[model samples]
Target: PEDSSRAASVVICMNTDRIRGAPMAEAEPTRTPQVDSRAILEMDRLHVSVDGATIVQDVSFSLRPGERLALVGESGSGKTVTALSIMRLFDAAGMETRGEIRFEGKNVLTMGMPAIRALRGARVGMIFQEPMTALNPLKTIGAQIAEVLVRHEGLGGEALRRRVRELLEQVRLPEPLRVMRAMPHQLSGGQRQRAMIAMAIACNPTLLIADEPTTALDAGLRKTIMDLLVDLQQRLGMSLLLITHDLPVVRRYADRVLVMREGRIVESGRTDEIFARPGDGYTRTLLEARQVDSMVDAVDESAEERLSCRDLGVTVGKRRWIGRDTLTEIIRGIDLSLHAGQTVGVVGESGSGKTTLALALLRLMDGARGEIRLDGMRVDGLPEKRFRRYRRDLQVVFQDPFGALSPRMNIAQIVGEGLDVHEPGLSRGETRERIRAALTEVGLDPSVMSRYPHEFSGGQRQRIAIARALILKPKVLILDEPTSALDAAVQLQVLRLLRDLQQSHGLTYLLITHDLAVVRALAHRVLVMLDGEVIESGSTGTLLEQPTHDYTRQLIDSALMT
Candidate 1:
């Protein structure tokens, strides 16, 4: 998995011309289309309901030919359901829809199943948020790309293969031959997403619906993918419909924006006007840029380090059944210092060894040839039995809370599991009280301690994970991609909570993420890693503004800043 993420960083950066494409604000067209007086896609007074619950009520919008319209909203705002209604995907899911969805002056809701199937890939194409799940796992990349071609264009054999490779080249993916032969699991996240885009645009659909297309990519790759979409839209002369929670992206690409909240469109206007002067309170709140106080000045340099590592190196190797196995160096000559009541941001694209460095510092691996010190004491070379006591002093919060927290375990058991091992002598009443305190500290309802992880939203589950880590009262926390999966509104909330907790408890944090905005808000110091080494390190304000390395500069420039 680490290798995959790393490969993404390496491949995308290796040939900027191939993946990044030309830096054109506008696309040049190859051909002109006859003007259509009617809107390309229009939804009037649309209503979407699942069972007896109304999710979307009276939503309306329209897209002109070759125009880009962005539907902006947080999670559970019915943005996705509205988009799905256009293609009549709700029918397969047993969801009810009402009102008119007119594409080319024909109602999509009144179409038969056979007609809808023909309309899907042939006339309307959609790029899902998560490509790994949307794509067929058992099929090769070529087969998935060719499926849409064969069904929609009626091509077969060499013609289909040729078209597939051309589409792959059109999306700017490197090495068409290698990519075609690879399975979904073999390719990286960016690669899978590019392949998905190729499949969607195979037939040159009239409308391209990109639902959070770059959600899983790092800042550089996000820019690349978005630019690629724009390039394709201009070349094909098709309208673009983008659905996302990323406000920066909306500002950068969308000609117009529709702000949605709780299944209703509260505001709609020109992109620049809406951003400059938002009429809706909710829109203003969504666009508000949070300012976080850095702890660098508050922290005393003379004080002992909370966590520090020196010459840390991690070599990954496989055990051989017959002879000596091969080994590869993952992390090399890594060194950093973290002080109490401060946050250090480790930033790089996927597969840059940021996670691997965190793993080494967490001491989650063995054969690490380096010195790891916690609270001015050595811990790396200690034996398992002797080092067991130090486990409570170090804790980590993972990226995906849904995956990190067990589905079968309730909130109380999940949070108090650490205490069961460290403080086994405590009474049940004390344990329950501690659990409640931990939950309350992270802004969760203490009464929900009996509920399971599945009962909460993405933001709520992340808070639960934070509670689980806080219950141990660790001096340092290693957060790996903590807010990348959350909505913009929810991400700010979590960052604020982390900041408040750090101020009150004097906790140290190692924030590992690809989000430059998050780094700006919370991190006092920043480390830019590439290919298993720290390329640059300095104060956050200084490093970000005056980056010395070209890679660091590229990272900052690629970020979708507000």
Candidate 2:
């Protein structure tokens, strides 16, 4: 192979010799060549429309054999449409597609349903963005992978079972047999993603289209997945169409990039060239978003007294489960404190009891066995009516801004809701003034007050959420993965705004997130949670830089990659 640039080349061979060994290795015969070093997916003047509105206009690109091409764009930017058009999977209702999609030198649009179906999984496979939605819930992970083999290769019985296990093992999943029998609900987020990857690669398709494959994964898991994708592409000799908006992923993984904005290709070039000297303004903006680094650096503002919890115990259900022998305790003996103007970041993976802790602090959960003190006032065991009075002091910014905000309400109404709930009969002028000020503080225009939630972009909507939280003038703000759903640029803006707000308003924050970059940038103190327990907790600088626990070290390493 003369072209080091053409294929996924590795420096050293991996240790695949120890897998089941002996008879298993002997039984597995070498498969036929799958990849062809020729142009696999080519689009020329591709135009698509929905409900008489043009979405993708005159888009042209080509995916060469063994080449990794990335389609970069924001939401509603026709990236998904282009990929769907190639697969002939676009909806017939109010949607129209035209122009040539030459896959293996054949026009896919002209092909019949049966012909396209034949080529779908056998010739090309797709790794969807959200594995949770892409994978079936009731089917076992193994059966899902085996479906591809059965459909395309016609493998059945023992041959199918062996191939399914081999595919799972190839993706580096643990206990392949067990995972095969387990439902999607039984696996973790990362494990589900690996299973999805295994299914995509089961048929050894010539072309693989991965759309935002790492969106739901953590930084460490993301790196592992990308490495796995590269390895699989190399071993299978498949052409990869990588679609994403993440610039760091582009810098580390993609060879060529096609930048899209408003359904148009704004710029197309090599990854290094695009990053170094972005010709388009949109490309530059995308790069700038990715480069939004740490903006929180000042003297320690952690107050000595603000809020505290002691001997905090919490359980969701009344009756003990696990055959009446084991009761699942979400939080047990959890002792924590937050000083005035201090930022405490709680880090953990999904279903690790991070959100449970947050909800308990707000007294949302009933029958919670705990002692929570706010400003020297005990509120944990207080009645709901009395706790509502103390709620003014505590504000929460949820993870999903879209879901948090009311679609029917305008910006001013959303921000003013807190004030209306707490202090009724307030003058409309006063309410407007407060709303405008909060919006201004979050880097949004006051003029957008009349706009509805749907009218604003995602970044703007998130700012509105922050403004809503800030409007309450709460002494302590609980940020539940506030920036997880936002893009890099929007996230930076929000973080910087929060820092400024905290300093100016004298606000203390309890930031709950899984992103270590955010923790390093904004957190003064760190709390690492795993399986409903604090594995490690200390000063942010010391804990992140010199993490003692293995989990903490892993989180730090994941953040530093690329």
In terms of lDDT, which candidate is strongest?
1
Model 1 Cα lDDT, one tens digit per residue, 105-170:
889999987777666635777776656656677889998777665555577999778777877787
- Model 1 residue runs over 4 Å out of place are 1-35, 49-54, 88-97, 103-121, 130-205, 290-297, 315-329, 363-369, 376-390, 401-435, 447-457, 560-562
Poorest lDDT segment (10 consecutive residues) of candidate 1:
7-16
| Model 1 vs. true fold: TM | 0.78
Count of backbone clashes for each model?
2, 0
Candidate 2, residues 446-531, lDDT tens digits: the string is 99999888555556777898899888888999998787655576677778888889889878889888788888778888899877
Local distance difference test, each candidate: 0.78, 0.75
RMSD of each: 6.6, 8.2
- Which runs of model 2 end up more than 4 angstroms from their true locations? 1-37, 47-57, 73-81, 84-99, 104-207, 235-238, 272-293, 297-304, 313-326, 329-333, 348-352, 364-368, 401-458
